[model samples]
Target: MDWIVPLILTVITASTPLLLSATGELITEKSGVLNLGVEGMMLIGAITGFAVTVSTGSAIIGIIAAAIAGMAIALIFAFLTLTLMANQVATGLALTIFGVGFSALVGSGFVGFAIEPLPSLHIPFISDIPVIGPILFGQDFLVYLSIFMVIASGWFLTKTRAGLILKAVGDSHESAHAIGYNVIGIRYMATLFGGAMSGLAGAYLSLVYTPMWAENMTAGRGWIALALVVFATWRPGRLLAGAYMFGCISVLQLHAQSAGINVPSQFMSMLPYLATVIVLVIISSDQTKIRLNAPACIGKAFRPAQ
Candidate 1:
C-alpha cells in the first residue's frame, strides 16, 4: 500500500524522456521516413544542452541548444537519404556513430557539471487531492504537456487535415505528389521535428531528471524509444502505454537493488539495456509484420521528376 503512490510517481518521472523521444519518433515515422539516428541525435542533444546550460546558467537556453543540435544532426540524415537516396539503415547507423564520437569529444569537459532543473509547476485544486495528488498534479510542465501531446497526437492522427496530408504522403509519396503535396519538404519538416524533440528529451534527462551531465548518460534510451514505436503499432496512444511500461521496468530495477536481491549489481546495472534488447527482439521477430506496420514509403526513393 505504501508503495502505490511512490510507484505511480516514479512511473511519471521515468516515463517523461521515453514519452518525449518516442512520440517524436512516432510523428517522423508517420510521415513515411525512417530515421534510425535517434540514438545519435539524443546523445548530441544531451551534451550540447549541458554545455549551453553550463555556460549560460539557463536551462531553457540549454534545451534550445539541444534541440538545435538534434536538428542539425538529423539534417545530415535527410540530406543523405532524402536527397542523395542512400540506404536508410546504413545512413542512420552512421549518424549514431557521428553523434557518439561528437558528444564524447564535446562532453568530456562538461562531464561533471551540475544543471538546475526547471521548477515544478503544480496544478491548482488537483494538486492537493491526497495520495494520487503528486502523481497527477505535482509534475513538471513538460510532464503534463507530454500527456496532452499524446491525446493531441491521437486526435491529430485520426481526425485532422494536416495529419491526413502527412499520412497521404506516407502511404504513397508519388500519389501525394500527384495530389500536389511536396513529399521532400514534408519529410524534411518531419525529420527536423523529430530531431528537435529528441534533443529536448535528452536535455530533460540531464538538466532535470539527473541534474548532471555524464558521458553517454543517455545509455540506450534512444534505441528503446525506437522500439517503443513498434510496440505501439505506430499509434500515439500506444506510444504512451509503451513509455509507461518501460518506465515501470526501469523503476523496478531500482527497487530490486534496494531490496538487495541476489542478482549482482552489474546485472542490475545492465537490466534496462537487457530489457530493451528483449523488447526489441520481441517486436522485431516477424519481418513481414514489422514491414506492414511500417509506412508504405518508408525506404522508397523519391524522385520529384518521376
Candidate 2:
C-alpha cells in the first residue's frame, strides 16, 4: 500500500525518456533515416541542460539548451548519413562512443552539483486524492508535455500532407525525388527532431530523476528507445504502450529490490533489457508481421539527382 503510488509514478516517469526519444526517432525512421546517435545526443543534452539550469535557475533555459545540444549532435549524424552517405550503423556507434566519452569529460566537474527541479502544477481535486494524487496529478509539466508530444506526433504523421511526403521519402527516395520532395531535407529535419527529443529525455534524467550526472548515465536508454520503434510497428499509439510497458518492467525490478525480494540487484537490473530482447524476438519471429511492420527503406541512403 505504501509503495504502490510511488511505483506507478516511477514507472511512468521512467518511461518518459523512452517515450520521447522513440516517438521522435519513429518520425526519423519513417523518413528513412536510422539515427544511432541518440545516446550521444542525449548525453550532450543532459550536460548542457544541467549546466544551464544550475547557472540560471531557469528550467526553461535548461530544456532549451538540452534541445539545442541534441540537435547539434544530430547535425553531425545528418552530415554523415544524409550528406556523405556513411553507414548508419557506423555513425550510430560513433555517436554512442562520443556521447559516453564526452559526457564523462564534460560532466566530471558536475558529479555532485544539485539544483531545484521545475515546480509541479496540480489540479485542485486530483492533487488531493490519497496516494495516487501526489504521485500522478502533482507531477511536473514535462510529464504532461510527454503525453502531448505523443498525441501531436501521432496526428502529424497520420493526418497531414507533410506526413504523407515524409512517408514517401522513407518508403522510396526515388519516388520522393521524382515528385520534388527533398529527401535529404526531410531526413535532416526529422533526425533533428529525434535528437531534440532524445536530449529532452536526457535532461529529465539529470534535472528530474537523479538530479545528478555520472558517466554514461543514460545507460542504454537510447538503445531501448530504438527497439521500441520496432515493437511499436512504427505507430505512435503502440509506441506509447511499449514505452510504458518497458518502463513498468524496469521500475518493478527496482521495486523488487527495495522490497527485499532476495534477488541480486544486478540480475534485477538486467530484467528490463532481457525482456526487451525476448519481446523483440517474439514480435519479429513471424516473418509476415516483421515484413508488415519494418520501414520500407529503414537503412537505405537517399541520393537526389543533380
Candidate 3:
C-alpha cells in the first residue's frame, strides 16, 4: 500500500508533460494544421526555462519565458506554413532538427547544473489523509493544471461556438471560409496555443520532472505526445486516459529495472516506445474511428481566397 501511492505519484509526474503537449497538439490538428515541431519546441522551452530560472531564481518567470520562447518558435512555423504556404511536414521536421542543435548550443553552459524542484501542494488536512489525499491533492500546480486543461478543452470542443468554428475549419476550410470564418487566422491561433502548451510542458520537465538542464532532455516524449493525439482519436477525455496509460508503462519500466527483473536494461528502456507502436498499430486497424474523429484537413496548407 505504501509503495502504491508513490508509484501513482510517479506516474502522475511522468504523465503531466505528455498531457500538456498532446492537448495542445490536439487543438492544433483540430484547426487543420499539423506542426510536427513539438519536440523542437519542447527542447527550446526546456532550455529557456532552465536558463531563466537559473538567472533570476524564479521558477514562475522561467515558465513564462519558456512559453514565450515556444510561441516564438511556433510563430516561425506559422509564418512559413500559414502565410507563405510552405510544407507543414517538411517545416516541422526542420524545426525539430533546428531545436536539437539550438538547444544543445544554448544549453551548453547550463549542463550538469541543478535547481530546486517545484514544490508540491500541502493542503492543511486533506493532503495528510492517506492514499486518496496525496493522489488527489498533493501534486504540483502543473499536474492540476494539466487535468483542468483537459477537462476544459473537452468542454470547449463540444460546447462552445468557437470550438465549433475551429472544427469547421478543420473539417472543410473552404466551407468554413464560405461561412465567413477566417481559416488561416483560426489556424494561426491554434498553432500558437499548441506552442504555448508545448513550452509549458518543457518547463515542467526542467522545473519539476528533473529540475536540471540537459541536452535533449525531452527524450522523445514529444513524439509520444504526437502519437497520443492520434491514439486518443483527438478527444480530450481520451487523451487524458492515454497519457496516464503511457506514464504507467514508462514508470513500470523503471520499476522493472529496479526490481532486478531478468530483462536487459535496454529492453526495459524500450517498453514505453514499444507500447506506443503497438497501440498505434491496434488503433490503425480501426480506420473508421480515426476517420470519424481526425480533422479532415489536417496537414493541408490553407490558402485563403485572394
Q: Which candidate gets the maximum lDDT versus the true structure?
A: 3
Deviation from native of the Cα of residue 159 in model 3, angstroms: 0.3
lDDT of 1 at 79: 90
- Shift in Å, residue 142, candidate 3: 0.5
Which should have the higher lDDT, number 2 or number 3?
3
| Candidate that beats the other on lDDT, 1 or 2, i.e. the better one | 2
Model 1 residue 278 lDDT? 84
If scored against the real structure, what TM-score would every candidate get? 0.92, 0.96, 0.98
Report the CA-based lDDT of candidate 2 relative to the real structure: 0.87
Model 1: which ten-residue window has the lowest total lDDT? 112-121
Ranking by TM-score: 3, 2, 1
Q: Whose TM-score is higher: candidate 1's or candidate 3's?
A: 3
lDDT of 2 by residue, 1-306 (tens): 877787888887898888888888999999988987787888888898898898888988999899888888999999999999999989988988888888889898888888897788779998989987897689888788888898888898889999888888888889888988888999999999998998999898888877778788888888889889889888899999999999999888878866779988899999888988998888778878767756689888877778
Instruction: List residue ranges in candidate 3 displaced over 4 A.
Output: none
RMSD of each: 2.0, 1.4, 0.9
lDDT of each: 0.84, 0.87, 0.93
Q: Could you tell me which residue pairs clash in candidate 3?
A: none
